[model samples]
Target chain A: MSASDVTRAIRRMAHEILERNFGCVDVVIVGLQTGGVGLAERLVDDINEIEGTEVPLGSLDATMHRDDFDLRPITSEAATTIPVDPTGKIIVLVDDVLYTGRTVRAALDAIHSYGRPKAIQLAVMVDRGHRELPIRPDFVGKNLPTRRAEMVDVNNDGVDLGEIS
Target chain B: MKALRHLLSMDDLDRDDIEYLLDLTERYVEVSERKIPRIPALRGKTVALVFFEDSTRTRVSFATAAGRLSADTLGFDVGRSSVNKGESLRDTIETISAMGIHCIVLRHFGAGAPWRVREWTDASIVNGGDGRNQHPTQSLADLFTARQHLGDLDGRRIAIVGDIKNSRVARSNAIGFSKMGAEVIFVAPRTLLPASLEGWPVKVTHNLDEVIESIDVCYLLRMQLERQNDAAVPTLREFHHEFGLTTARADRLRDDALIMHPGPMNRDVEIAGVVADRPNAVITEQVSNGVAVRMAVLFVLIGSRLDLVEEQSAVA
Candidate 1:
């Protein structure tokens, strides 16, 4: 996937979100920390550009809520800023890549500490299939099936699938 | 990055580690600001608060930090525990570790208790003031509070006043501040000052009034009356008159200079009542930051272990 591919995917995702949510009323977009933050911000901008209406933006860090905490390196924490009350609001969780589905699960657990939202919807720039858990993204930009050893890198340059080595 | 297993002393951390922990503390500070001031960081993890000494602030601070992180905290009651039955410290620590405790926040009258406990158990040891050895977390909180008011610690002049010989807070703060590039000045009467400033990287002074004008922070240490001998001071009145942070001395300090104390303060003895409660006084903020700092420490130790375990399992 190229940079233009990512841009087009983001625009499509934004339009899909607006169309499905029925014009963005009470809709909130939250980017996962680190990778998802930039993508979420861009998605919010795209949504605003398309609808000419403002939507609430937030960033959630799922480091502490991770299930694989005891097996990995110490995860660095990022700021979780939910500017508006998530209660009774539609929460659209945005992320860069959906791999193990563990991170999204962690994000779901982390969000409860904030407030119980009416609904939470997951949006990913790319869904590389190799899930260890029974989790799925509500909105996916691209669904790329890959081996377990493969890595997906998503950024301004767009998404690249390559071997870990 | 390499994970810190035990925080036995301020010496165990470098400038980078201190800065990292302080930065990590900002996240917890944000968590604390939320309507629900709790996180699932340490959920399902157990932490033991093993205090052989009586401490209201540090003990409560660690407990609150663990609770906010959602960790199960077991406050070891030295009063009722097997210590009363003459069980050894080593045995007690091993027994607790055997029960699957993840971390131990220890406070003991004997210096190096945490360091020794580390040899006995794999549980990460956090020194919550070991005798007169070191209170690394208190220093971390002090640094956090100082940074809150003073902005940056680099080249900041900090005068650690009062009982230097018996103050673990002073010892830890001296090492921590200097490591962070702060100029540390030890202020005390001749008797109260350490016999030798030999190895420590700090300027020793007998007069607080002279340096009060130049200092960025007047960090007053409690005059440990219980630890002091008759020769340590002529009298409490004379000590307060000469070395204490009296109103007159406080008047000489810079307007922006911060007044700090590791409580509970002996109001009239080490610092004037008015000085302690003044707007520039950040003693309360230090107490509040204490929880955040400890939470950061706990997360780094226990959280890292959890991560490492999961990583190994994934590899397997």
Candidate 2:
């Protein structure tokens, strides 16, 4: 996927989110740290520009809520910051890629700690299916099917599918 | 993540290590503020609290930190345990290690007990408080609290006032603050001052008035009623007049100067009761930050994955 394709997908996703939610009432956009932060910012910016309404933006690092901590170290470099209380609000969780579904699951666990949201919808730039958990994204930028051993890279440049080694 | 086998002293950490741990401490602080203030960072790991001495805050703090990380904590009570039956420290440590624990948070009246215990157990050893030696986590908490109020401790002035000779907090914090580029000043009477200050990176002053108004932090040490038996001063009243953060002395402090105490404070002896209630006094914050700091320390030291850079020995 090219940079222009990623921007176009974000613009379309912003439109779909408003249309699905029926006019974007009490909508809060939270981007996962590192990868999804830029995408979420762009998504919120596009949504606000299109709807002519301001939306709250926040970022979360779901490292602490990870279920496989017994298998890896907890790196808490980036802090989780939610500007407003999420109680009874529609939270649009944005991420760069949807793979394994573990990160999204951990992010769900993390968001519940702050407050009970009215609902949560997942947005992803790329959906590379290899889910170990029953989780799905509500919005997707690109659908790239690959082998289990392949790696999907998402950045400002583009999305590249390649082997890690 | 930094590989650490044992956290025995403030000397074990460098400037970068302290900053890394304190930065992680900030993240833990955020975790603690949520509706559910617990995380499963160290699930299935066991942290044994092998405290050979009596304590209130340090013991509770470490146990709470381990629990927040979803690790099991087994507190070995000295009074009720085999210590009464004359079992050796080594024997106690071996017994705990045989059960396969991940860490041991120890507080013993003997100064070098954690080092000796580290030899007995494969688990990481954390010095909760080892005699008059060092309380690394307490100092870490102090640094974290200081950083919360002040940005970086690069040029801050800290006046550790009280019985410096008997304070593990003072000893550890002097090294810690200095490592962070803070100037440390020890204020105490002649009898309460340590015998040697040649190796320490601090300036010694017998009078609190000399640096009271100039310091960025006024750290008051709890009068060690149990440890100070040397007739350090004429009376408690005299000590209060001379060095205690009396209302007058508190008023003399800089408006932004932070007043701190390690805990179980002697309200009238070291710090006045009214003065402690002042906004500048972050005594409560110090105590609360203790949990977060210990959480960061424990998670960084032992809760790391097996594939990371695993190294032995502390006090680098």
Candidate 3:
């Protein structure tokens, strides 16, 4: 996708989120570490612009809760920061790309330890097919499918599809 | 940089390694603060506790860290093994290695024993404490806890007082704190200090009174009760009078100055009982951070390389 397209999607997603949730009084926007942080921040900015009210923002890294820990080594990519208890609040989990859905699974496990959220909805900039787990994104910017080994990298500039050298 | 296969000493970690481990400890600290206080980071892994000395906080801290990460622990009963059956350290290590453990947290009465254990086993070795050599995790805990209260340790003055010669905590903290840009001062009776501070990166003083008010962190070390018999001090009372954190000395400290001790403390000999009750005393927080630091160390050791198990198997 192009830069304008990405921006437009984020803006529209923000409006859709506000309309569905009825103004975000109980909403917490949690972005996945590294990849989703910038996107989440942008979404929160858009939401704030629309509602004139700030939503609690947090970033989470799910390396600790990953099921593939034994098969592959993992490192904590970033710090998890939730400003308030997520109990009884709607958690809008954001990620840059939704592929295997394993990270989302791990993130679900990690979030449970904090507090049981009233509900969790996944938001992704791109939803590429090839899911190994039963997980789906509630909000999407784009849908692009490719071979398993191909890489999908999303940034503020745009989305790039390429091989990882 | 390649991640460490063994956390054997403070010397094994450079500034980047120390910074990474401590930063990672912050995340574990957050996990600890959560309602569940647990994670599955080290799931399907096992860490063997191979302690050859008496311990309380360090042992319990390691066990708790492992449990929070969902790692299983196999504790070697030191009481039944070498002391009774006369099996050597070599014999015990080999036995644990044969059981296919992933990591070993070793505490021994002899210095550099963890290095020898590293040679005997492919499982990663963490120097829980080996004599007066090093206790890197405890140092990490100290750094984490101190940073929590006082922010960055950079340019901060820390007075590590009492039993300097016999303390592994002193050795580790001296290196660990100095590495983080803190100015470290070693205070003790001359006899309790190592014969020379020739190459040590710290200031040495026989007086705590001079620096007490000026220092940012007053770190008290336990006065090993056995030291009195060894004639290091004429009496426990003299140690208290001279170097201890008595009410008078405690009163001399800056109100915001931090008080830290790596625990199993000598209540009256090193730190006064009432002084420990004060708000600035962060000895309890040190114990709490100890578990988080240990969890970070374990996560670093176990999850450092994704193909570690494969590499180990291929090598074997």
Q: Rank the candidates by TM-score, best first.
A: 2, 1, 3
lDDT of each: 0.90, 0.90, 0.89
Which CAPRI category fits model 3?
A: medium
lDDT of 2 by residue, A8-87 (tens): 99999999999989978989999998789999999999999998988999999988778877665555558788988999
Can you write out model 2's per-residue Cα lDDT over B98-146, one digit (the tens) per residue? 9999999999999988988988888999999999999999999999999
Better of 2 and 3 by lDDT: 2
User: Which pairs of residues collide in candidate 2?
Assistant: B12-B315
Question: Best candidate, TM-score-wise?
Answer: 2
lDDT of model 3, residue B267: 90
Q: What is the TM-score of chain B in candidate 2?
A: 0.96
Alpha-carbon lDDT of model 2: 0.90
**Which portions of model 3 miss their true places by more than 4 Å?**
A22-25, A69-75, B306-316
- How high is the lDDT of residue A56 in model 2? 95
lDDT of 3 by residue, B206-308 (tens): 9889999999999999987653556899888988999999999899899899999888888998999999989999999999999999998988888657356
TM-score: which is higher, 2 or 3? Answer: 2
Per-residue accuracy of model 1 over B186-254 as CA lDDT, tens digit each:
999888776777899899989887798999999999999888766788888988999899999998889
